[model samples]
Target: MSPLHRLGLATARHPWRTVVAWLFALVALGGLASVGGGEFQDNWNVPDTRAQAGVEELRDHLPDAGGSSAQVVLHDDHRLEAAVVHEVVADLRSTDHVTTVTPRLSEDGDTALLYVRYDVPTTDPAIYEDISGLEHATDAAADAGYEVEYGGELPGTATSLQGRGELIGILVALVLLVIAFGAVLAAGLPIATAVGGLAAGSSGIALLAGIMDVSTSAPTIATMVGLGVGIDYALLILTRHVERLRAGDAPVDAAARATATAGRAVLGAGVTVLVSLMGLRLAGLPTYDAFGFATAIAVVCVMAAALTLVPALCALAGRRLLPRKERRAPEVSRLGAGAPRSSTTGIVETREVKEPLTARWATTVAKRPVAWALLALTILLALGAPALGMRTWPQDGGSDPKDSTTRAAYDLVADEFGPGANGPITLVADLDTVDRAEVKQVHADVAGLPGIAESGPVTYSPDGKLAVWDVEPTTSPIDERTTDLLASLRSDVLPEGVDATGYTPLLSDISDLLGQRLWLVVGFVVVLSVVLLALMFRSVVVPIKAALMNLLSIAAAYGVVTLVFQHGYGASLLGIDHAVPVSSWVPILMFAVLFGLSMDYEVFLLSAVHDDWLDTGDAQGSVVRGLSRTGRVISVAAAIMVAVFLGFASEPAVVVKMLGVGLAAAVALDATVVRMVLVPATMTLLGKWNWYWPFSSVVEVRGAPAPSLETSDDERDDLEEVAR
Candidate 1:
């Protein structure tokens, strides 16, 4: 027996022991995570970049310039009083995390802005608490008829929607599973296994957090992937178990066989996901690296649960796994009143007696291979067309929910001072000599630039060797206009002695860096996936076809994201108020995730086909047999994933929403158009060449028979029965 069969038997033999052990591990890990898990760091550390160099210089030379800053905007219909403004500024300066506070009164005096600098990055929990308290301190201005709003990283960090996205996803998945399996017990087993896997995975992320700088978004992303794939992996295994039970195998023997077959597929799919996620590390961004590791941990945990816990549950449930209604006798019609009536019912008779529509569709596609293949390719290509115009930028306060304080503050700042006031570019200069005249001239030249809204007075370091000036732009932080301004300043406008180091410029630099490195990362994942698929399937053409199809699916997903989020095609439907650039890290992360997920269907369908081909040496027969066998389960699994992913579409965070919508669309297209139509059609056209290799002659010379389309009708009938 294979090791997977051995594992299933071992788990089945001692179900309670396995259950108890998993429960104990979950509890212990949960407790440890609660106590020792470190905070997530939003560290966008891009080494050997100009931004890093500038930041390091400031941190080393100027104490007050090292940390992040927040903005407090006060608005009133009437002219604001100087006294009240002073009082608010004094209160802000008194806050524990506030290092310095600078107040600016609008020309009309109806608005006031206070810039408060912090001693640490805004993602620090302590800094967030301090900012919250500062907001309360500023409440007195609001009480006095002045509208108070908080902006910048503080409010943005504090207002993340943290409720029930995962829970809702799981509930939706459960409903889909119930509908697919038609058995509450059968459906619940996958969910149970998923929950256990998620518990362990989440705890593992927490432990990793304690040791490294994981991103704040890692847990949410990990949860989304872990739950969807966990349930999917278990569902596949359980479906096979049900098939074996219906075939009249004993419960333990059925579980072992199912595990040996479906469990191997699960392992391959999980490893594909892991490899894709780990490819994020090649992007050379800390956030992506952390995301990769955290997600990989979750996948590993879920894959293990599918292998061990799912089989244990299957063994414990036995024939009772199927719903009672499904297991009961079916009503058969009598051909004639005079004829002797016989009531004959078995598991398959009571269940779906006719072949599924998917089987018929596969047969039709196989008959017209070229046309179906072209149609599938056309659909995917059309969907992916919009990706050509995709843009990337960091999400800012403008993308925050309108009700959030950050959004309010952003609007007030834009309405009063300027949109650029919310995101200013600071110039830090290391001078050979303290020449006030030269610094003043440099500031004037910067202010005269095309996109400049205004410029702050230059402030020099105590030793007078360094100077800093805040240059406000005429657009929002995430606007392409602002990026253009940053580019001109860095490349054309700024003097040789000066360097830009501010939130807007830093974000632009990060976006550019990610965009530049994106291709390398994509190439790595594609090549890695290709090599892995080639080795597993032992065919170059199959791996190449799979990789290309996966890319097509991912591109379609990107195009959807571009249309909805970038072009505002369906922005309102998804609750987005306006079009925004795709988040810089989103496409890279999405590619890794979607490629791996798309492979899940490919692996499932092709592995079954390969097994059939090894037995019968007929490629076309194997493709039909494989599709007819795995199509329903693949459809059900894909539906579960789509439901789970789209469940998070309502997330207030635009990034999360993008991920949700993109993943859902990708999975839907991949499972149906690509898997059902394109794959079988392509294999039909290739015939025995589908499995050809340069080394085939050597194997053939060693007395191995060549693969041939010599399968008998009896063998086809048996395969069809097995599929059913």
Candidate 2:
């Protein structure tokens, strides 16, 4: 058989391939899950500060941080009397991990706070299990005639990570997949694959973290990306394969042909996505490097599953998969061509694409590039306008709302007490020495800083050599006023002290660090994409255009995301209840993931156009027809991604929300607007000029195509018809 027929037969035998792949993945998944952290978080969200200088500093100064920590809170105040606190503290000290505990007077004096410190490190693997025993410790309080009420970080962090993160995410993810894929089983399969695939990937990350800077966020990202791309891509291929089968071929033949064509598309798209994500390595931030590596791992595994495992499963469970197909027929267009369309509710059955932009849409867009391009550019810019005004930096969620307060507290304090009440500005001073007078001078200077509404006393490092202070700025963390004040201190204030002594300054060095890395990160993102695309297209111009397109997409999506999340505009309607920061890590991550996904579409759509141009030499016809043929699946894949990723927008955390929303928007726009129109139209304007530089030698290309473009209209027609 020819390569075409061979691919068809392989797809028809997809069941076996799937079984083999699953068997392979399952072993890795099992090993991965065996060592999951019960409740440790990497705390990447929390930037390192002079830990001894902040609340810890205050607590240290207060004479005791060793307070009795509470695990569960009770609404009844009378139950948490002094008797209850004393008894709980007494009982907790008996536990091995509980080094000491002290009871405290609550803000009201009617209620009280208990501070607890562990003899063991919080990073210990058994911390959750040990901390979970707190309820029993509280039970001891009840015996002493007090209803023990409790609350703190140990409970919240442990419970959120161990109990809620995956459970809630899994449930939500499944519902999202069903909604996105329009088939329950179809959606479920990808989720299952991801569980296994991501599990293995997370294990690698954790293992890597043991030596590198990989943190708890790495796993969250690993899992999320694994599930998002894995399911999204698998569902795309599956849906396409089923559609091809419904178009007339047998299950076997359909699987094979779809495997060859759509599989190739899926594989090529996966490669592009992987390439895009891998580009983040260029950013030079070790965290981003780890993220880039982990993300690349997931993309690779997801592609493997989508092509090999999914295909094999199709072969094995060819007909039984429609477990609900009999009932679903009326509502879904299954793989069986003769199947009848049913109700409109289930699976969102439809012959046409969802919310149809209208079939006439293409013709209209084709007719008026200037109008649509202007309109799109206008909308994107308008969406991004809020971003130009955006401000953000790293923040630590650890102290915000503290340990005792639940979700009930953040807004209450931030609103009535001012946003500054939530987080304090930490000042780490590497003075010439820890001389009492020098320390006192820096203290007075920082305290006098404009935004310093309040300041706690400074504390010396272990050797009494370095002092650190905590300042509660009147301004919010991300406010221009605060950053301005910080800059002023760094530029004007720090130099005076530093000049007094020949010692290097913290602010000075850090400033230089950020300045150097900024351009490096930008250059990394741009250069890698250019190199990858150039190699793929063998045209420097193509790579440049692809990079430009990706930049436009990222900028546009970020603009809209900032508008929705940061400006609190339409957030409520989207189920976002309050304003939020655009995750600081989002820019680079979007660069990697979106760049990959956008380029995925780029390869899928453009390759066909390029193939046409190569074979028959009609760039215009090839562009139009290529887009037309690939348009449907590209739209479907993008739509599926939109649903999966946008589902994550419901997450309260900005990072998860950003990843989902940013990615969804980028994929959707790139497919519909960029790939379909801008690319085609731009190429149209360029005509044969697109292929010209093949003769020039500005950029590198080795053994690249020396396409003989000379051809007739008849030849172009034949190639175009065949390619379709």
Candidate 3:
């Protein structure tokens, strides 16, 4: 027997032992996480990049100006007193994390801006707690009839997830499973397996946090992937077991057969996902590496649970897994069949059947392969057109929810001072000499540059070798104009010795680096996917076709994200009130995730087709049979994924919402348009060439005749056995 069959038998025969083992592991990991798990670190430091070099230079040459900074915007309908501003600045200086606080009054005398610097990075979670005292101080100023708002990364960091959306996603997944299975136990088993997987995966991430800098977004991304695949893998195996039980097979035998066949598909699909996620390391970004490791761990835990815990649950429930009506029906007609006939012994006799809708659809596509293929391609191309116009940048306070204090402060500053007041570019100069007249001349030259709103007085380091100038832009931080301004300053405006470094310049550098590396990451994932699929199916054409189709689906998803979020098409529905550029890292991350996930359907369907092709040696017949058999299961699995992903669409963070919506769309399109329509049409057109490789001559005759749909009872039994 295959190892999968043996595993299923072991779990089935000793359900209690398997259950206890899993429970013990889950509890032990949870305890370990609670006691020893370290906090998540959002380390945005990209090494060897301009941003890193700038940061290093500042820390080395000007230690006092090397920390994360925020702006406190105070406004009063009446004239603000200078004494009150000084008091507020003093209170801010006394805050635990604060290193310095400097206040500046607006010319109108009604607005005050206080620049506060912290010893820690903006992405550090500790800054949030430390900012509480500053918030309290601001509250006191507010009581004195001034409006206090925080404008910068500090307020943005305070918007951590409430986790309600994740719960809702699971609930929705449960509902979809119930609809798919029609029985409570059968529906609950996948959810149980998924929940167990999620617990283990989350705990693993927490433990991993202690060893390295893991992004705060890692948990959410990992959970999204883990739950989707966990439920999917279990569902595939459970569906096969049900099919076996509906036949005349014994419960244990059915479980074993199901695990051997469908479970193998699950295993293959899981490996593809793991490979694709781990390929994120090729992006040469640390955050991507952290995300890759965390998500890969989640996928591994969930896949293991699906292979073991799911079968154990199935064994424990036995026939009780189905409803009473289904269990009592001794010889029910096969799925998608018309009706059962009464045998002479009063036992109902049934024949193996195909889903009429999916079968007819497949036949139709097979008849006019070119038309159907072109139609699917056209739809994808149309959906993907918007991607060409996509713009990417790191998320900032300007993109925060309107109700957030950071956003309010950003608007306040933009209104009173200038839009660029929220993000000022800094010039760090290694001066030949620190002469006051020469520094003044340098500041004057910078102030005369285009797009410069105002340039502050040059501040010299204590050692008197480094000089710094704060130059505010005329546009918001994420504005394209601001990016152009930085480019102009770097190439034309700044003197030879001066270097620009600040939030704006760092983000700009990061964005540029991402754009350059995006292709490398894509090429890595594509090449890896092609190689993996080629080896798995042993067919060059099949992998190439699958890769192209997956890219189409992902591109379509990107276009949808751009249209909705960037173009403000459905932003309000997803809780985004303003249009924002896609997050710089989101496209690469989304591509990795979507490629892996779309392959789930690809592997499951193609594996079935390959099995059918080998059995009958008839390419067209295999396509029809495979589609008819796996169509319903794949559709249901896609539905579950879509539900889980879309559930996170209401996430407060725009970046998270972008991921949720993009993933949901990609899965939906892949299952329906790509899998059901494009794949079948293309494979039908390929005929015998679908499985052709350099070694095709050794396998079989090149022109084997296609078989008829009907077959003898023995042949039908063989087909059904293989299908399981």
Candidate 4:
């Protein structure tokens, strides 16, 4: 027996031991997390950018102004009390990590802005806790009849892994499982296995955070992926095991066979996911790297559970995994009335059940492959058209929920001061490399620029080797005009050795970097996936085709995101009232994720097809039989993923919602149009060439009878003609 088969058999033989071991591991990890876990902090370390260089200079030369900062927005609807404002500023200045506090009133004098600077970067773990002092100081202003809100890093840094969305997704998944499996206990097994995996994986992330700069958003992203894949993997294995039992095999033998078959596909699918995610490292951003690392850990743990825990659970469930009516009936081989049984596990007996609806559909497509293939291609292309116009920017507090303090603060700042007041640019000059007089001249000249709404006086660093000037533009941070202004400043305006930094400039730089490297990341991920799929399936054409199909799915998803978010087509339904640029890194992240996920369905379907091809030696017949066997299961898995992702689409954060919606759309399309319609049609067109690979071992089975399908005489003739 193969290693996977042996492992499955061993676990099935001692089901309780496996269960107990998994439980102990989960509890131990949970305890470790509770005692020693470290807080997650985002590290957006883009070293090559000018904005990053400016930030580094600030940190080195001016520690007080170098650290993260926040804006305290105060409004009174009438003239504000000077004493209360000063009192609040005094408390903030004494707060821990507070280095500088500058207060400025609006032109109308009804609003005031407190610019508070800290002594640490926004990614520092201590900053989140220390910011509470600033928040507490604001309470004094609130008590004095002034409305207070926070902008910048203050409100955007908070993170949470718990929410109603996760619960709702799991509940929806359970309902779908029951409908698909027709047995509550069987449906519950996947849920149990997935939860076990999710718990262990989350604890692992907590442990990882203790050592590295894991982002606060990592856990939520990891959970979303792990939970969906975990359940789908288990469902694939359980479905095969139950099919084996109904074929009259002993439970242990059934579980072993299922693992040997479906387990291999699951392993391959998990590897593809990991490979695609790890490709994020090529983006050369630490934040993206951490994202890949955290999500990969989740996938690894869940995949392990699916491969091991699932078999044990299946053994425990036994006949209960089948429906009540089916379990009560006598065991019989679906192959035929007198099919021989083998002692060794293998595909010696092929199932000959009546024609399933999927089989009929596949046959119909096979008879008219060109028409069906063209239809699928057209739909995919049409859906993907909008991606050509996608505009990307890093998400900011401007996209926060309207009720949030951050959004209120952002709006207030934009309204009272010009919109440019919300995001200012800091110019830093390195005196060691540039003339100090020239720096002052450039600073003075910038104020007269067309986009400049206002400019602050130049302030020299304590060392006199560094000078800083803050400038505000006339447009909002996300505006195309603002992006053009930044580009102009960097390429044509700023003198040598002088660089710009600030939240807005930093976002623009990050967006530019991601845009420049987007194609490289896509190429890396696609090439790697194609190579891996080629090795796993041992067919060049299959892997290449799979890659193309996956790209189509991802593009379609991107188009949908562009339509919904950038065009404001249906943004209000998702709680976003205005059009926002697609989050800069979201597409790369989505491409990497979708490529791997789309492969899951491909692997499952192809595994079954390859098995039938080896047995019957008929390419067309194998496609029909494979689709018939695995179609319902693939649909269920896709539906579960869509439901889980849609739950996250309801998130308060725009980036999370974009990810959720994009993933859901891709999975739904891959499972239905690509896998169901296009795959069958395209494979029929390829015929025997589908398995052509000179480097791989080739098997020949001559004059072998194909599996039976229940169809009318006319339909049978058409299928036979297509097979010929």
Candidate 5:
């Protein structure tokens, strides 16, 4: 047994006091709960060299200009009567921080928009206050004896998911968890553990963000993950404990064995998961670095809960946790021919391996490596077939949320006056004491370009030192055609002194950046994961083997995502409204998550190998036996994560949905096919290769081999050895 396992078992000495203390402290943590929102910006890293700069210039010219950009559309219902408009405008402008309201015109004359302007940036408290203003505007219109409705970015995103968002989701999840577990107490325990873990996790995220402005999308992500995974891990330990009590053991012994065994899984899984997330830091994007580090920190808290509070609490509950029927269950059968009496509700005795009824899933591949490899390649190719059909790459700002008003207005304008009307190409040319006529010639050159649809009146800056024009293109903003037009504006039309920039220009720049830098990120991930694995295993070959497994898992996930989201296969069943362009960030995010998740399974399955090899010195046999034994636990864990991801995917927003579905697909594949079948078979084929590397495999076990399925005596001493 690993020293950690022995150490955890030792925690069962006084479980009840630990339980009481945990419950009391958890209750205290609840009262201190406060809601904190994120940086809440659409584009975090865009530079001011393009049309973005021009937009800022326009905002700067306006009086007391607030940096808020929102779309307020009045539907073409009879609600747009003068009284309704008057009431809306009155309420909106009368709001404490609101400065202006600009109404947009519909093609028809009846509908009018009241653009509710704010004097504060999106990150300010006033952004939320404006949502209240929206509510007031709606009420004011009704009070003035007119009907009105309001929907926009501010309400859909800002207000709807603000305070107690995680708490609300937890409450709903609690109801589900209680029903699934068949005990209120059982369900409550996981929630308590998760809340404690999240409190610590969020603070960790704040620390990371302070170091570098990590992607603002991280908090929501951390909350969802920390809660879900923390709760699930706690449930796994609790379930094992209940099973132990059902058998014939006392509370302390039952808790001891439960912590010794399941604790191994939870701690190993958590560490693996944490390491995998760190893979994103390899990608070099500051955005992903925040995501990786935040997830890792949260996962660490989860590991702490697993190893400390949970085991202690289980010990405290004693026989009360396990009913009389469950108390009769035990680990092994006396006859060695029949199952034990522990048909406990949570624990069922079952055969580890089902005889091959049709195909030996792992063995078949193990016996015929080339044939299985070819078959795997063929399946990957078939799934990737839909990549050919993924059109609609990106429009307007690539970062534009599908429901953004500017993009929505651009879409409507495109449908009517042509896509060109939506995005106007910007011409930025420097001015000096020289040649005013040269600037005019530059404007004329761009104006006469074939794809120019609508040209704005030439406007110079306040000092007459700069000139600019808004040139509508023949395509929607950021489309391939517009990109081509942008190229023309820069290369063919611009005079020697003129510069052209727009949404397309920024997209172009980012594309170049991604192309130049993405491989460096990939290399970092590979090197880091390998080095970490070698350090953990004391076998260089182990890291190489792990990298291959992680790649396969990631590729399979990409294939699944491509097939589902890109090809529109079973998308409706998946609740996806549109098979839109997957975000450019998806690949980076997937590598980070997949690598981290693969580490989780690796730690889990490899821990068994580590233990068995120590006990039996049969590497291949150890893999088979360890895989057979750990299969159910990892599968159950993976299933829960998949369900969590799928549930989140049901949201309306495409990006958020993409994240969920992508992780769901990845986990689903990882559990069944990758972990169960491919991993065992491939490792079986490459016997010694699984442990080959530049460094020698430790002939003697290291002092500590991470938290895995087994324990070491020396490692136990380091963990505060106690006589239980």
Candidate 6:
């Protein structure tokens, strides 16, 4: 027996031991996490950008002003008392890691702004603690009858994973499972394995956070992927095991065979997902690297659970995995049309065998392949049209919930001051290299720029080697016009020695970097996926076709996201008040993730089709049989994925919401239009060419006798003609 078969047999024979071991591992990991886990932080430090150089220059020459900063906005019906503002400033100054606190009152006298700067990088865990202390200090203002809120990098540096989305996704998955399997025990097996894997994977991410800069969103993203794939892999294996039971195999043997077959496909699919995710590293951003690493860890844990825990559960469930009617009926020969021999139940009523709906649908497509292909293509292209106008920017405080302190602070700052006040572009120059006269001239030019609302006097470092200029734009941080202004400043206004660095300008730099590298990541993922598919199927045409179809589905999903989130098509329904650019990192991350996920269905369907083709030597017949056999399972699996993803789509974070919607849309399209209609139609048209291989000699082509069918002689003849 193969190693996978042996593994399956061993686990099924000792189900209790397997279950106990998994439980122990989960507990141990959880314990380790609780003890060693670190707080999550966002890192947008792009190394090669002009913004990064500017930051480095500041850090080298001006230690006091080189750290991250945030704003405390206080509002009252009357002018703020000087004593109260002084007390708040003293409190902030005493906060840990706080280096400077500057207070300014609005001309209207109703609002006050405190600038609090910390002596640590925004990615440091201490920064979160600092924000907490700042918030606590600002609470005194609230006690004095003033409304207070926080804004800027320090306040917006954290990403939260807290939401009802994950729970809802799991519940929806369980419901879908029960409906699909027709037995609670069988359905629960997948859920149990999935949850076990998710718990362990989440714990693993916590541990990973201690060692590296893991983003707070990593755990949530990991959970989203791990839960979906964990359930999916287990379900695939369990389905095969139950099929084997119906075919009269012993529980151990059935589980072993199922593992040898379906488990192989799961292994391939899992590896593909891992490889695709790792492609995120190529983007050369620390945040993207963290995303790739954290999510990959989750996928690995879940895949291992599916491969090992699923067989044990299947063996334990035994005949209970089958439906009530199937349990009472005698084992029917799956290879031939045979009457039931006997039954445990006294009444052995027989029912006519009708053709499966999937099989009939396949036959219809085969009859008019060209029309079906055209219809699927047109739908995909139309859905993908909106992608042409897609725009992307990094998430800003403005995207936070309306009630959130960060959002309130953002709005207050924009209202009290100009909108540009919220995102001041800092210009740093090395006085040793650039003349002070030239620096002054650059400042004057920037002030006269079209988008410039205000410009501050140049402040020289104590060492006299560094000078900094602050310029406020006439637009919000995420505004395209702000980006244009920054570009003009870099390209025309600012001289070579002056570098722009601030929250807004830094995010713009990061967005530009991601946009430039997006195509390279796509190419890497697509080419690698194609090669993997070709190796698995041993057919050139199959992999190419699979890649093309997957691309179409992804494009359609992108279009949907652009329309809903960027164009405000249905933004209100998702709680978004206005159109916003898609998150800059989302499309790159989504492409890597969705491409791998789309492959799961491809492997599931193509593996079955390849097996059927090897068995019958009739290409068209195999396509019909494969679809008939796996269509329901694939559809249910896709539905579960959709439900899980849609759950996350309802999250408050726009980036998370965009990713959730994009992934869900792609899966829905891939499973429906691509898998059901397009795949069958295209395969029917390809005929014998679908199996063409340059190295066919290495593959064993079986010429076994065709299996007996439930169809009438006339129907069989028609199918054979279509196959020819």
The TM-scores, one per candidate, come to 0.93, 0.73, 0.93, 0.94, 0.76, 0.93
Q: How well is each residue in 222-287 modelled by candidate 5, as lDDT tens digits?
A: 765676578767766776676655444556666667667667767766765676576666553556
Per residue, candidate 1 scores C-alpha lDDT tens digits across 140-214 of 797789988888867677666565677787788788878887788898999999989988999999999999999
| lDDT value for model 1 | 0.83
lDDT (Cα atoms) of all candidates against the true structure: 0.83, 0.56, 0.83, 0.86, 0.59, 0.84
What is the alpha-carbon lDDT of model 4 when measured against the actual structure?
0.86
lDDT of 2 by residue, 1-724 (tens): 4464475476456566556656776676556545642332342211232222233332343322312233333223443556666666676767656655645353454433444556433434556324546767777555655444433445434423322344555676567656644567666776676665665665555555555555446666666566666765666556555654445445676556555655666666676666666656655445666676667776777776676666555555454444355434542334434644321111223466453342245445656657766666666566656667654444223222233243333333344345554445555554453456766777787778777777777766564434555566686554557556656665687533222100012222222343345455656656876776666656656668777777787778888777776787776765555676565567667666777778777877776566556544555655665666567657756665676666666554546666777777887888777877677666666655565556553322122222234545565456445533
Q: Which ten residues in a row have the lowest lDDT in candidate 4?
A: 701-710
Q: Which stretches of candidate 2 lie over 4 Å from their true place?
A: 1-14, 32-214, 235-254, 282-286, 316-360, 395-421, 425-434, 458-463, 467-469, 476-480, 494-519, 574-577, 691-724
Query: What TM-score would you give candidate 1 relative to the actual structure?
Result: 0.93
Q: Pick by TM-score: which candidate is best?
A: 4
Evaluate residue 682 in candidate 4 and report its C-alpha lDDT on the 0 to 100 scale: 93
Cα TM-score of candidate 3: 0.93
Q: Count the backbone clashes (under 3 Å) in each candidate.
A: 0, 22, 0, 1, 19, 0
Give the backbone clash total of model 3.
0
Q: Model 4 Cα displacement at 592 (Å)?
A: 1.3
> What RMSD does model 4 have?
4.2
Q: Give the Cα error of residue 207 in candidate 2, in Å.
A: 5.5
Measured with C-alpha atoms, the lDDT of residue 231 in candidate 3 is: 91
lDDT at 194 for candidate 4? 87
